[model samples]
Target: MHGLIGQLRTTPGGRGEVVAALVEGARDMPGNLVYLVAEDAEDPTSIWVTEVWETEAAHRASLDLPSVRAAIARARPHLTGMGTRVVTRPVASLGA
Candidate 1:
């Protein structure tokens, strides 16, 4: 499986909006095993997203989806900075 972990820092008071868009975009996505959005405990404006997919291609294809495009557009303004983006090969997960 293909997986990704992204860390984002949103504008002041914008994390909620960003998280909302990310979740909405991923709703009912095919090949998506996990899509988790979490807030940073130490930083109020920071958010983290963890995604697992059946294949790298499926994850890439998700970028072209209409819902994803819309969500990206919606969240763009609130995105102030990005921290880390790491790719991984997922072997297994309890809930995924």
Candidate 2:
């Protein structure tokens, strides 16, 4: 499985808007096993997104989806910077 973990930094007080856009776009995605968005406990303007997909290609294809594109457009204005990012090969899952 393909997995991605990343941190997104938003403009002041813009985290909620970014999170909303991401969650809305993630509602229906083929090959998506997990799409988790979480607020950073230590930073008000930081958000973390963790994604799991059946394959690396599946994850790449999602970028072209209309919803995904729209979400990117919506969130772009609020994004200030990108933080830590990691790509991983998932070997197992528990509840997913």
Candidate 3:
């Protein structure tokens, strides 16, 4: 499976907007397995995303669409810094 993990520091009052963006991503994307999140207790805006895709190409292809760009832009205003990494790993079971 192909996967992406991202970490982001959110600006003040950005968390709500970011969450809305994530929800849109979930609703719009086609080949995504899941988008899991973790938030910092001290800072509501500090967040991480662990996203699983059926294939890397599918995720990359999604980026070319205007809707995906718009969804990403929705969170841009709230993001202080972010990083994403893609990985390829063997599937051990259907659980993955």
Q: Best candidate per TM-score, number? A: 2
- Encode model 3's per-residue lDDT on 1-96: one tens digit a residue: 787777778898888788778777666677877777777677776777777788888788878777768878888888889755546453643654
Cα lDDT of model 1 by residue, 12-93, tens digit: 9999999999989889778889999999999998999999999999999999999999999999999998999999998878
Query: Per-prediction RMSD in angstroms?
Result: 1.1, 0.8, 2.7
Model 2 steric clash total: 0
Candidate 3 Cα outliers beyond 4 Å, as residue runs: 83-96
Provide the TM-score for each candidate, comma-separated: 0.95, 0.96, 0.77
TM-score for predicted model 1 compared with the true structure = 0.95
Candidate 2: give the clashing pairs.
none
Q: What's the TM for model 2?
A: 0.96
lDDT of 2 by residue, 62-86 (tens): 9999999999999999999999999
- Predictions ranked by lDDT, top down? 2, 1, 3
Q: How does each model score on lDDT?
A: 0.92, 0.96, 0.75
Q: Pick the candidate with the highest lDDT.
A: 2
